[model samples]
Target: MDLPDPQFSEFVTAFLKDRGLPVEDLQFHSLPSDGSKRLFWRLSPQSDTSFVAMENTPTDDFSKRENVAYLMIGRHLFQKDLPVPEIHHFDLANGWFILDDFGDASLQESALPKERRISLYESAIEILFRIQTEGVEGFNTEWCCQTERYDQYVMQRYEANYFRDAFLHKYLGLKKDWPELENPFNHLAATASRADNQFFLHRDFQSRNIMVSAGKIGILDWQGGRLGPLAYDLASLLIDPYTGLSSSERDEIYQHYLRFLNKYDPRQVEPFRKYFPYLAVQRNLQILGAFSFLSKMRGKTFFEDYISPALKSLRHLLEDLKDPQLSPLKEAVHS
Candidate 1:
């Protein structure tokens, strides 16, 4: 029960008091930090009753937007009966909130057998479909933290440029311009931007963000979600470097998602599959970039461990796509 500094403790005490809860008996334990600047603490009041406190330390306007987006999107999803944490209390002015504790059983930490993993992934896919469809009915772009849409600009700037700067330059220290890559990135951005089925895209739909507790899957860290190609999130999940899913497993999960889409919206099946690989390439590159940035710039060295897996995933995607434009990227990655 190592408490935070006195000021942080006082803040939490006052916050709990406002909600008619006594903090004198509560025990607070700091949780491990993620890539984001937010700090998390799990506060336990009883054997079974606990809450997770989140404190957002916004260094600039961008992080501030993320703070607000988390609260707004979280409330919206909870109201829609989505499997997100229930917001207990939030104060936007000070950037702190308490939420229902989903426990520490993230999909990344799950050590389930093959059968259980398949079943859990099936449920996750179903929930993803609902978020893409039902979750978009009343979704407003104004609630998005940064980019309103996962358009070409986002692909070029955030995904491609991020890979170029963070992974290629900063991490790998690759100086070669690799002029051949420009055309591939351009083609990918163009094709991905024109994807037909635009829906709510969970920008970081990886294993770590999916929490599994009591046989139910709960989504977390959705502050960066926005309107984007349906394949973006699907790609993010299946090609997640952390999960290390085999080709067969990835195929099974992808087919499952297709079956669900066909049952609900058959019209989207073809286009979704057509754009999935391209989006996967984009997602993998973004993951590599993010892992590298988090490791080098943010000093979270654990992310460095995932860089090789991310590169491998990217190489596989490029090879499977077999697009001539991607040849240069393939060569560079292989090199």
Candidate 2:
């Protein structure tokens, strides 16, 4: 068995001991890691409810920022009565924290039937809408670890350029063809920039990050939260390739969200609709880049399986929109 670091285990042990919780026969079990550098472990004890611990040892500049964001944004959300885990103890310099454990089942692993699944998605949407609206209050842009706002620069560099460099050139062997995408990529970024970006955004609000704990939705991987277009996160959820929600099923769920959006502001709905597809395409592009990089370069092969389906989704979306500015992007995915 891969044992936890003695110091970290001691950290958890002492932290629990101070809270009057027994730590007898304590054991640490390592959990599977995702694309990010953060590490997770399940801390089990003799009888108390188990808690999870996080290790955010930074390997680079971005990861260093990720650690801070996880703490600041995480505490901020917990204070807002959001569904995030309760942070118990943290050692920022040492990069470890203990939290309430929601268990191993993700929304991706949710085994409900179609109708019940949609119902669960409805709950997810409700929580997300609250996160979007209420999360803006007391949210400091300074607390953001990534780009403070989802702007054109973020679209170009992280989404479009990432797609070309990582997914196309690196993964698909289209090295020479990237130059052709410059113009349309610029256009797409500019178009997506028109969406309102003041709303709180969870940059990766997909099924895998959602936890369905005993029938309630609990969100994780929230360190990437930032001020972004309202459409982007919703688009990420609806088009998540892992869940493989059908076109009609997505439509049904989308309508459910529209009702909520309408309740928030009737005028915002039309504008949200106008810019949603562009934002969705931007999200899909980022997805391709991220998945390819994680799968091929980082050796996390789990994401490799979703690339084809994501591309197919992008192609279908473009074909339906028939937008001229994105034609080059469609062509790139086609090749």
Candidate 3:
């Protein structure tokens, strides 16, 4: 994509100069357009030190409570020594943020040897466990809606329907009769709204939201958080569209997560396991619809890469479900 206007670039250059950094040409590296809410640029001023300049778009305005809750959670993760980016400075009023420049260190472009992949994922799993256990404090779970509370009447339900109707039918030619889907849809909604599974959800916790630097992974794009099932974020990561980890690798991670959860709260372990597959199925379907909507209506097909893994997860979820109410939907998807 073309770089943003020279005015913004010049403004950033001047801002850095006033900060007494250095004097030279300013080079800006804008990331891909998949994440539109935030704009990232690498500000290099010919000096040894460099930093990342970020601007949160207007659409990313979060409630003060949500913002504070996220920051508190981020701080808690940092305190636990998790490999997340450090916030340098933030101007919420102007939507400008500066963070430590991790430098060409992303899993997408990593030059690490093959042997290091397992270690990286292991570390990621460990930290995820820590968050699910200890990261429950910063946010109020009682207020934040859980996946179980996400019924057909919930406002979020429209996100899925809109994705399907406006995008899948309108653009992809994959149309579903609302009447045929009503029963299964209602069942899915009721199942989710039972509020059975609840935990700290990272909302967008996935590989793309993760940064790999110095053989460590750091999480970003966590402005939206809530109290929900751990599986939501776990599925988002392992079944991430940008990166589809192998089945064996995903299984290994799932086992690791189970172990961690069991150790954290033995009582909730069974419930988590019982509901994890259901959450995965629900989340995968929502994502599939969202991807189509984003690709068609929103004019961003970047989510296409995530479709196959998401489908695979749907299949796996189906294998775990013995509930008759969900079987028809599973058949519809599989068919």
By TM-score, who's the top model here? 2
Tally clashes: model 2. 0
Model 2's TM-score against the true structure: 0.97
lDDT (CA) per prediction: 0.85, 0.88, 0.62
Please give, for residues 220-286, the per-residue lDDT of candidate 3 as tens digits.
Answer: 7555555656666777667665555677877887887778777777876677666666566666667
Residues forming the 10-long window of minimal summed lDDT in candidate 3: 142-151
Clashing pairs in 1: none
**Predicted structure 1: clash tally:** 0
| lDDT of each residue in 1-335, candidate 1, tens digit only | 33466766777788777867766677778887678777889987656668899888667888788888898888888888999999877767767788999989888768246667778888899999888887787888899998888988889888998898899988998883656678988998998877864588779998889999888999999899888888999899998888788899989999999998899889888888888888999898899889999999999999988899889889888989999877888898888
The list of candidate 3 runs beyond 4 A from truth reads 1-19, 59-81, 108-115, 140-163, 166-168, 193-198
lDDT of 2 by residue, 143-201 (tens): 78889999999999999988888998898887745677889888888888998999999
Clashing pairs in 3: 148-192, 148-193, 241-306
Cα deviation of 207, candidate 2, in Å: 0.2
Top of the candidates by lDDT:
2
Report the number of clashing residue pairs per model: 0, 0, 3
Q: If the candidates were sorted by their lDDT against the true structure, best first, what order would they fall in?
A: 2, 1, 3
Local lDDT at 262 for model 1: 95
